[model samples]
Target: MRPQLRLLCDSSFRGPQRSRDVASILREVDELQAKEIVLVAQDLASYGKDRPDELGAGSIVDLVRQVSAKVPRTRLLYLYPSDLSDALIEAILDSGVPYFDLSLQHVSKPHLRRMRRWGDGERFLRRIADIRARAAQATFRSNFIVGYPGETEDDHDQLLSFVGEASLDWCGFFEYSPEEGTYALGLPDQVPVGLMHERIAELREMQDAITAAKRDELIDQTLEVLVDEPGIARSHHEAPQIDGIIRVPLTLPTGSFASVQIVDAQGPDLVAQGADSAS
Candidate 1:
């Protein structure tokens, strides 16, 4: 069984079929005894013609509690999955879920318009910053697409700056992959593979620096790091895996806690010393 699993609400559209569907999913998750789950109500936002039932107040609270209590380590991740506002986000986090995942393609509004993903980089980053300010320990992640057709060098630069500001824990940089039946597929002058790879590399480098700085900001701070065995030292920005894991570097007799010092920085893992004779 995967340590992290997503319990996604198949539909977030406002319809009789979706309203109570999420609650039912929870029941099944409990049956399976799933402890850690990332619950997402995908496409919660308005998708063209239909405005699905917005993840309402009471409903979101109920769902957050259901998953949190049932699974101690459970976290709820909000996706472009719906039309939720800052109020709804605050309510949801207040309700229990502290992890927020926003889908952001590019910082360039023009690029976003081309792709048809609503919202600009500024607005989205503000929301994420707000969320982190509200909940410091909250996990923030986002995905961006590079090399979209008609993307200029300026567009890529803007994205790099935006990533620096966002300080996202997890940032995914994707080269534009055209899928059949989508508007992007019909677009002309698609980006070349070599250029796309270059852009991806640039964006990744910027993100790497931002992540390192953010992780360094957490130096010497106590965190209830989740343990992943067979781990090694990396950097403050990195954990065990690419996605990251909380590393406690002492050989524990059993599962236990140790005080660690942030000694170095790697991609996303932390190099720390733990469990000395002295505290």
Candidate 2:
């Protein structure tokens, strides 16, 4: 029997800054025969902020390269800084990791400030464009919070418009939940729960269309999907469960790779036939 594992590397452990010995981890990964890796940096920019030898974006990029060279068969999924630079974007494109997730809570600049985020939606849109320019196959997903304190109709409009423009392949939205001892808990004009539900529905509706359209674009394109099960496959562009799975009609051994031609888009899932065989 072979050992199976998923490497989840966090930027912070017991503190806001901690340096991970990536080489050792990769060596272990090689020994374990893991096929996928997920890195949770929380805030990539601020990673290692407290320490003198901080693990920054460059470290992640280097890790990706090493993983590719050492375990070329493994695929990577990671959370990145919301505010991305061109160098960081290019490094990611070079790493051959197809998935990119950002924590874009709100679009309106005013709303973002309320959430303590720095950038405007326009900046984020530009970043998206940058990633798309470098890697057309890049899988983009993000998380958003709707119905925050002091949210107004215009703020929602901005967020919706941003979503329309961004056309993220997959997204998760939740009504803002007030947490104990959080700054948001005391903010004025807290959104009504009823309105929060309505907003969530509307955002989901808009995103559903965009996500469907994004999925439809992959038709006829051949992707080297990793067989996760007898009937399902996943490519670099598709993450497990959240981004949904690709349906491969033929039975294939799990943990194997097959070239699949996407033939159908059933909402978030894509139906695929082996590139070498009949559907």
Give per-residue lDDT, candidate 2, residue 95: 53
The per-residue C-alpha lDDT of model 2 at residue 275 equals 26
Residue 68 local lDDT, model 1: 65
TM-score of 1: 0.75
Task: State each model's CA lDDT, in order.
Answer: 0.60, 0.72
**Number of clashes recorded per candidate:** 19, 0
State the lDDT of candidate 2 residue by residue for 1-279, as single tens digits.
111335434543334455457667677767867455444455543333344454544565556556666543434443444535565566556655567777788889998888887778898898888778878888888888988999999999999899998989889998999888778899999999999999999999999999999889999998887776667777877766667778885667777777878988888888886422222
Error at 169, model 1, angstroms:
2.7
| Tens digit of per-residue lDDT, candidate 1, span 1-279 | 223555354452334224445656677677766434555555433222231454543455456556666764455554572355665576456533466666666778888888777777778877777777878777677788888888988888888888877778778888888777767787877889999999899888887787777667666765544343433322222322346544455563223333456554455655555633221
Q: List the residue pairs that clash in candidate 2.
A: none
